[model samples]
Target: MTLFRQIYALLFVLFLLIVASIAYVQFTETQSFLSKQMESDINNASHSLGLMLVPALEAGDDVATETLVNVLFEGGYYQQITLTWLVDGKQQVWTNDIRVTGVPQWFIDLNLFKPITKENVITSGWLQLAKLEITAHPGFGYHEMWRIISNIIIVFSILFLIAILFARVGLGMILKPLNSLSEHAQKIAKRQFGPDMPTPKTTELKELVRAFNSMSAQLKQVFSSLDEEVSALRKKNLVDHVSNLPNRQYMVSRINGWLSEPSSGALMLIKMDWLEDVHSQYGYQIRDETIKLLAEQLHQQLDEISPSVIARIAAYEFAVLIEESERDLLTRYLQCLIRTTNKEISKAGCKPNERFNIGIAERLGQMTVTDILAQADNALQRSRQDNKVFHWFENSQQQLFSREDWRVKLTEAINDKQFQFRWQPVMQLENTEVSQRELFCQLSIQDNMLHAGQFMPFVEMLSLGAMLDRCLIETVAKHNLFERNLEPIAINLTFQSISDQDFHVWLKQFLQNHSTPERVCFEIPEASVYSDLLSCEKICHIIRECGAKFGIDHFGRQFGSMTYLQNLRPSYVKLDQSFAFIEENQHNSELCRALVNVAKGLDIEVIVTGIQEQEQLARFSELRLDAYQGFIAPPEEIKLG
Candidate 1:
């Protein structure tokens, strides 16, 4: 019950008790006063009649005496009047009026009230000649008594109402601060509030708000540190050891997670056109330096507009995922990644005179992470083979995915099971060794292995993205674990999945019936959580109760204030390829140093996924990473590149 209701109930009960007591008192007093007043009036009347009748009786005037008795009987407020004669010690009574009516016996017998009667005698001036008796109407007394009781009840009832109204309004005023405190607590829990307190009316409540804000500020700092630590761990987890670029595992993992939500921008996959040529002529160092420069330039350019992930998914392969626009951030950012590649090479002590050929591919969404990369790669491959600038996916790229077509496919896929899970190792980089593997999901048919890239557009067009996520989790849990050694596998779900109004209730039941989260990764992307931050917190709190680890798959892409990161402590961060690649080729450089220092202060374990060689291991070793995974530590896996 609410505070007001509890207080109102208590007060209302007390009011009932007081009103009942007052009614009883009023009834008793009314009965007593009425009885006394009636007796007095009757005694006065009898004395007057006695004095007058004495003369008439002494004169032996029976007519006058009888007439006096009759006149008394006719008087109102008297129920009965009687005259009695005493002969030699025996009394005879004559009554002209009787006052008795159908009054309830229960009412008459009740102690709170009683009927009244009076007696009077007509006697000579010296001695009594005759006695007179009168009684109050039983019904009249009860009616009057009831009227007094009713009036008291009505007056008390009005008072009770006024008290209730005053109590409600006054209590609300008194506890206003407490109510605000409750709201503040909720907002703080959702990571929406800062260290400010709500002003309160009461001193104690004000003090409580002040204290809460103080503790909230302290907790904010503590969580911020933990958040940074976790994010650092996430970034550390996604690097290439040799090249210091994110590996294929991190790229696919990060990209799909980003695209799972609706994006306002585009996703592009850029491949080095003459990567093979550089390897052959310039040797490994320059070639590696060239790749690292591309990553840094892209990251420097693309980060402000949309988050970009640079990953070396394959040998000579690199991909970028941007969440902004094809025109605003992507088009311009893409030019920097490819166009400025040679200019930055000078800092790496490379020849500016060295001619470089590049193949780049990019696609505008709402495309999945891989398909965009594939098109970009396809464009790059075509550009390299045909010797042109970056080639976009041709054959009417925008028209290729009509809403009607994908909607049908999504509808059919949902009605029938089609998605499956692919396992990639999340290497706990201790002593430069791989420790564990986490599974990601992909939709599979007879031919194409559709990552979120190919099929999500269909799901989105059909407006069934949330349903697709459910299907994916269910499919992955059913198929992947039974067939492989998948542990702590996290399948990234779209924001829509978490924010569904009935999400928790439905998800709880789904897990109960379909799959438990022991080997399941209910991976929620950081961006997704950030978008619907409040709802995301609620969902995370609920989901975490199931003992599943809450992890943001791709981090370092969103340009968010660190405050939120401090509050939401995800399992780990998957670093952006830009930094990973910078660390890769630059080796012991300032940028990499800053990245490490910043990440450490946050207490996050660094995991590097893009390392392409043993020589690059020195860079991460100095970073004090908790774990690292990349080409150097790449384990044998068929599902991963």
Candidate 2:
């Protein structure tokens, strides 16, 4: 029981005992006084009656004596009265037997007031006439005692109720401080350091709250310092000091990470031929300033194209990675870059063509980082030899479908529902059990099956993500995936779907109709979340309201602030595939460890992806992740019933 309840109960019992004791004392004292009064009244009455009856006894008037005794008996105060003649030895007795009235039988049975009898000798001119005896009725005593006791009980009951009500209110006020302290402690457990609690009026509680607030402030500071240190380390190792862009190391890591997935993009290398000339003519300062200015212009132009990375790979060479395979879009962006760079060159008092050369390489089937880099370098050499402003690396491979053909194929697939579902299980490290299954869908066209990576870019490019997501949700629900198994199914949501209000409404209805909403988890990429945090947060709220779950995919890929994790607070986060290479470099290891600490501190589960080998799993095990997902085991293709 709560402390307030226990204290209240004890007080109530004590109050009852006190009232009972007072009632008992009052009852007994009233009974004693009534008994004494009854004895005195009976004695006086016996003497008065004996004297009054002397005339009748002297004249030997039996009728008058009987009348006087009968009158006294009818008064209801005396229980019995007797008068006897002593001279003749033939007793003349006037006896009256009466019952007590004006009181309950139970109260009379208590015998609180005992019956009082008195005897007296009657004298007439020095002659003993008769003896008189009178017994007092206990009815009046019982009636008077009952009234007094009843009044005492009624008054004490009122007082007892008032005392109990006041005691409960007072106890609640006194313990309010402890309740506040408990809530503060729970926040601390979640690593959420909110504002300090107000000090309580009680001295001990006030001190306790003050100490707790101090600890919370200290903890917040410690976490802030750790985050700052990690940020500084990342900047020093992966960022270019002059251009403030990602350095060569960071670019290479990102390229490898992208290549691990079935994705397509292009890489452009910009060679600044005039940097060396400027350095010799003016100074290193002016040359650095020119590079910085060029970097700023590039950022301004390419900032709109997301999933793109700009890096200063060499002292005089800069690289831009764009995750776009559409030739027209690529060409438009390239033209804009050329115009922007030429403008900067004129401002620096240099000829645009003589100042730089550009090389472009398109990502093709199953290409590695080295393959793309080599292709771009060959293109650069060709551009310089041809004395051209830019050159493109040609590939013999052709696309599987044209833009129109892809549109037609995807539309047909969606309409006809020609999609196959597959899932890979994420295993918990401690128990080696399936935590959840990451869902994947493939388009079955003719005799070929294409994975999401092969066609998802087109889906987003065509703005058909909302349609695709709706279809997938309906398919999954129709199959009753949750009822078939206990494990939750994690579905990756598109930026387009999450940003669409109609899609949100549809999702809400779908989840509501499903019997087990908890078994559905919607995941969004980290890049998409950072791109539109408010939209993502809204969708997450909707999902939670429907009793489903939300998670973040490729969690540590973006360079945005980690503060969003505190606000969104997803159920779990899947680390970017790049973290699988942690065993390759010290910087990678430290970055992974720091990211793990940040997420785990917030009570968020961290899962590492791309675990293809035992050694990778062993290395990540040191980080104490909740689960892992990769090719350690092949993905199982789920057949729909």
Cα-based RMSD of the predictions, in order?
11.5, 3.7
Model 1, total clashes:
40
Candidate number with greatest TM-score? 2
Lowest-sum lDDT 10-residue window in model 2: 89-98
lDDT of each: 0.59, 0.83
Q: Which pairs clash inside model 2?
A: none
Question: Per-residue lDDT for 224 in model 2?
Answer: 75
* Candidate 2 per-residue C-alpha lDDT over 537-612 given as tens digits, one digit per residue, 9 for 90 to 100: 8899889899999899998887766778767889999998877753467777787888888888788999999888
List residue ranges in candidate 1 displaced over 4 A. Answer: 1-6, 13-25, 59-63, 87-106, 109-121, 125-128, 134-140, 186-195, 228-296, 300-308, 311-338, 345-523, 527-641
Alpha-carbon shift of residue 521 in model 2 (angstroms)? 2.4
For lDDT, the strongest prediction is 2
Tens-digit lDDT track of model 1 for 1-641: 98767877898888888878877787678878877776677677767766777777667666787787667656646666555664334343444344335445566567443445556665555576666566554455666776666677788878988998898898888877777788788776655546587667677677788888987787667656555654554455657755667777556655554544334444455444465566787788877877776666666765665555566766666666554343434557756655566565455455542333334444444565556666666666676566554555563545333556667666677668665554556566564333345444455554656565556644543558678777766665555452365446556666677778676677766655544465544656656756788877776666666656665544454534445444555555555434444434432244345444444544544455555666665666666666655545443433421
**lDDT score at residue 17, model 1, on the 0-100 scale:** 87
